[model samples]
Target: MFGTDTDARNAQQPDKPIICEVIDPTGTPLNVRATPNGEEIVTTLSNGRQVIPYKVSYDEKNRHWILIGDSLHSWGWVYGSYVSCLSA
Candidate 1:
């Protein structure tokens, strides 16, 4: 599982629902991985798709990754750089 300090910080915060939109500049569907920066793609999200961020982790290169889904189901992880989140 994710064990980054950023992930720890997010775990300490209250479970506030934050909505984020996929904004892949290439206009192609964004790959949702099973782990941060992982090659295993669990799914794909198109631009404008709204998702709820459940957790966050940063990779060694400092790329941000978010765990996204609804309240009951977790879709997977996506590169945070391609997502635009609004304040909750």
Candidate 2:
């Protein structure tokens, strides 16, 4: 439904839809954790943590994933409404 017949007729590129670019709130840092429950925090997302955030791997039953500065990582499931795209 996101595309037209031209999309369905051609070889589908599923990778595009699975990726989401995120911009954290300015002046506020975010936490990258080993688990979604906020334990085992891996890294501290500094102010202006501009990067693509991955949560639960786009409905992945196994786990989640996030891309930090070209590094592919994983995360927990986050609802769409809970995330906001900040303006640069």
Candidate 3:
């Protein structure tokens, strides 16, 4: 039921497609969270890799998390600190 095209399109998208580079300083892969929190790691996204941002959210702690994924995959949340939005 999730990851539908209409659902993704209807989700809060950016003004434009935002591509970001993973900037994790530890050189380890970044955790892609199922939610906008550290406890729910879904997968690991490598540093220096790019992802398309779909939505942005400010958590209770004031940290911004970006919803990222490609057309071929479902979106996942990543902490904004580890991502640098690049020009399209």
Reference-based TM-score of each model: 0.80, 0.38, 0.75
Largest TM-score belongs to which candidate? 1
lDDT of 3 by residue, 1-88 (tens): 1123333333355555556778887788999988888588888988878887777666788667778898677568987777777446
Q: Judge candidate 2 at residue 32 and give its lDDT.
A: 58
C-alpha lDDT (0 to 100) for residue 5 of candidate 2: 30
- Each prediction's RMSD over C-alphas, in Å, is 4.8, 8.5, 8.0
Candidate 2 residue-wise lDDT, 1-88, digit = tens = 1133332222124354332344344445556555553356666655433454432332234323332333464443232222332222
Count: clashes, candidate 2: 2
* Residue pairs in candidate 2 whose N, alpha carbon or C atoms collide under 3 angstroms: 65-74, 66-73
Q: Rank by TM-score, descending? A: 1, 3, 2
Rank by lDDT, descending?
Answer: 1, 3, 2
Please give the CA lDDT of all the candidate structures.
Answer: 0.77, 0.37, 0.71
Clash number by candidate, in order: 0, 2, 0
List where candidate 2 sits over 4 angstroms from the true fold: 1-14, 17-27, 53-88
The CA lDDT at 4 in model 1 is: 47
